[model samples]
Target chain A: MDSIRLNQLIEENYQKIFLLALKMLKNYEDAEDATQDIFLKVYENIKSFRKEAKFTTWIYRIALNHIYYMNNKRNKEISRFPEAHEMRTEMNANPSSVLHEKELFVSLENVINLLSPRQKEVFVMRYYNQLPFKKIAQILGKSLGTVKSNYFFAMQKIKNDLQNQNLLEFQE
Target chain B: MKCIDKNILLDYLNDVLSSRKKKHIASHLSECGHCRRELEKWKKILDITQEFVDQDVKLNPVPPHAHITQRFSKLPQNDESSFWVRYWVKPAIATASLIFIALMVFFFAPKTVPELTENYYVIDNVTYTETISLEDRYLDNLETLYLQEIYENEELTYDILYGDWQNYEEVLNDLDHDELEELINKMYDNEIT
Candidate 1:
């Protein structure tokens, strides 16, 4: 593809891709690096893109792979679960409706981070990105049944965790 | 479909299920209070997650360094070094050095004795009854007796001395008239020469 096409792809998807990396990696610096790295890798391998899969799916695949690899490489890098808890406590301190949505968002993020990597990915694709299970399966290079199972298990785990944390009571 | 698996219900709410399946799961959700409540909880979670997506992630989306894209651009487009270049460099260099040394030795060394034929000699003089050689100098022959000619009446036996033994003494007992005449004529010829 020409530079113009590549530029358009980046302009459209840069934010989503950056958010995905940031969500997975937690730290801004790491997320930015990961994002840039992911883009560079995408640019490098753009020729290999098959028309059968969606571009978003391919980008997410690359982003997820990069996150896992980065996490695996540096054990000292902590998960973003702390921000989730911090935001939860921070949100409760202010009793305004404006912050209520943000608090719930933080709670959801916490719950997401609590999930195992596979389940978290499946959950993110299924719920956060609103991706279909078939596309999710393709991005994850797993069978559709496996994707379903991952999503199922992830929701169960989140339910259990929420119940344990007493966050389930807030569901109306 | 007995108790809506909360997970399946989540999929259902997302409209990810087929039409027939959604109807079947919806029936199960209505009949099952616990499943219904769980599904509500998940809907809340999804709503919360969507809210998070809308909220500012509180991150500087601008990459830390302005030159990050530039850095990325400069990274080796292809990481592979040429295969032959990596492996053949040392061997090619060594081969060149070896050829250089061989050529030096071939072109710069001194000429050898074998090239000049310095070990041979030639001798000319007389025939011998036996193979004979001088004591010191190999160029001289050392036979003391030789037949110069066969006469009608008899053969003349003369002593031939070579090298330092050129002074020779004859040991003949009698001399015939022809022999005497021959000896006399030889002596006379010697005197005249």
Candidate 2:
């Protein structure tokens, strides 16, 4: 693909892809860098994508591979989930809203970090990126049943984790 | 009504279930308090997940497209490295690994241990053939003369002595000039003249 068409594709998918990267990598700056890198990769190999799958599927495959590689490369450097993004949020707002946001953020981090790598990918792609399981299956090269099961197990695990932490309480 | 599984309830929450299936699950949830509670749990999980996405999306806003395209223009094409990655890297690694493994196997494989007595022979002072080495100085005059005579004539009946001819150089040295000349004349009658 020419640079113009590649530019358009990047513009269209950069945010969603960045969000997926952020959810996976848990750092905004890292996510942005990863997104840019992924787009560069997409640009480099766009001609070879061969329309057998959706462009998004091919792009997402490149993205997840790069993100996973970065995760492993930076594993030693980042011990805890990245709280730098959370820290940068405005704390001048209402204390209660701030606390609620902070609590939800912690719970989210717990669920994400505690999940198995496969479930985490499924969880982020399913809910965070709001991708359909079919597309996720194509991107991951998994059977649709495998993708659904991964999503189900991820959601189930998140539900259980939240209950254990009392982050989710039912009304009487 | 029997309680539906929480996973199906999750699918229902995501609007992934078919209308017929949604209705069946809804009917069950209405009658079953436990299933309703399970639905609440999934709903809470969904909310938390959405919050996670929303918060993250808010944090890492995407870059401007023009800037990304500009960056793309700045990046080196590096087409060769990409081609190598796409085509050759795995095969190269596989071939290298196979060679390494083969070498390791070749160097470490067990074989018949060498026998200690293979090179050890007993010295027989009593029953032994004479091992007389026809030794001589490398360039003794007589030896050189003999070799020269043989080299000059391909057909020589008396050449290349193999017996224990000890001190043949001394024998030649003992001869006087006349005797030496006569010996050379006899050794190569036509060639010397």
Candidate 3:
């Protein structure tokens, strides 16, 4: 460990970063390796993290950038995540509670891909990483109100899509 | 508690609401079935998301961290020695070099004001002194040589023959007999040489 403080920071944020990258890259091995690379980048450039933004926000910003670069290199769009075909075949075999779970899972995955990039980012940072709106705003360099608004629109879209697919019962 | 705003329910489910708002929503949720259903819907959504994240983490193994540990040992630590090297040692060397340059300039700069020296001169037939230059000494030597040659040819020269020597002769009359005799012997000796 470089220091107890750095180690503590790494431990605190590692899982969230890994999950976030995994979601963005949609490749397990790539995400895992990118996660390590992100941490190393954080360690190398930690001194430049301004006191204005919270440390978590700064870390999130770096993780986002690294994932984006990897995605560009792979020439991947948001929709081109893990093979849905494989999961579909597997879900077809199980038709009980597993199907229910798979429906919700598949609905979320579909809705996620259909989201606008900004909305998707806000959605991921909010739901998957469980970050606060205020932190997301700082990380994205937007106003708190703007972040809250983006999240609002993203959730509305998800809820709307779910209703269209009959995943949830709601007015159009 | 009126039917909750769907956005409020979402915030509530996501735990982004303040604790006070949360309590208010919780009470509303307890009393109201419609709001409760709305909250449940968001709660389900969040639960599914949370599950997805957890499942990913659990299934995908975190890579081996041995390299990070190995790299750290080779990396320089922020110790006292390094701090001194960074903050003080380099500056000290630079400062020492600047002082050395200043001192060299001070010691070796060309002087502007000429030095004063004692000069010798005669006033009222009494000696006074000042610094003498090489040119003044040379001129004095040349003057002495010219005077010597004139002295040797002083006998019957036009200036001497026609010159006013009456006052000099009167002064000579006051001289002692032995001095006058010595002068006459010297004059005859110079004329013959």
Tell me, by lDDT, which candidate is best.
2
Off by over 4 Å in 1: A47-54, A76-105, A170-172, B29-34, B56-193
Report the C-alpha lDDT of model 2 over A1-172, residue by residue, as the tens digit. 4445545666667777877787677665677789888888876775566553377787888999999999897775444545642454333221222334578576766667678878888887876677888888888999988988888887777777777878666785
Q: How well does model 1 score by local distance difference test?
A: 0.64
List, residue by residue over A1-172, the lDDT tens digit for candidate 3.
2455555666768878877776676656677789888888987876555453377877888998998898786665435755764564455432222333467666766667677778878877887677778778888999987888788888788777776777764432
Candidate 2 shows a clash count of 0
Error of 2 at A65 (Å): 1.4
Ranking by DockQ: 2, 3, 1
TM-score, chain B, each candidate:
0.31, 0.34, 0.37
lDDT of 3: 0.70
Which should have the higher lDDT, number 1 or number 3? 3
> What's the true lDDT of residue B47 in model 2?
79
DockQ of all candidates, in order? Answer: 0.13, 0.22, 0.14
Q: What local lDDT does model 1 show for residue A88?
A: 53
lDDT of 2: 0.71
Superior by TM-score: candidate 1 or candidate 2 = 2
lDDT of 2 by residue, B1-193 (tens): 5678766777798888889998898788779888887777678777767877676556545656566666545544334366677689978999999999999999999976565653333434476533322335433544685568677875552334433344677798799999988888887867543
* Evaluation by lDDT, superior candidate among 2 and 3: 2
Using DockQ as the measure, the top candidate is 2
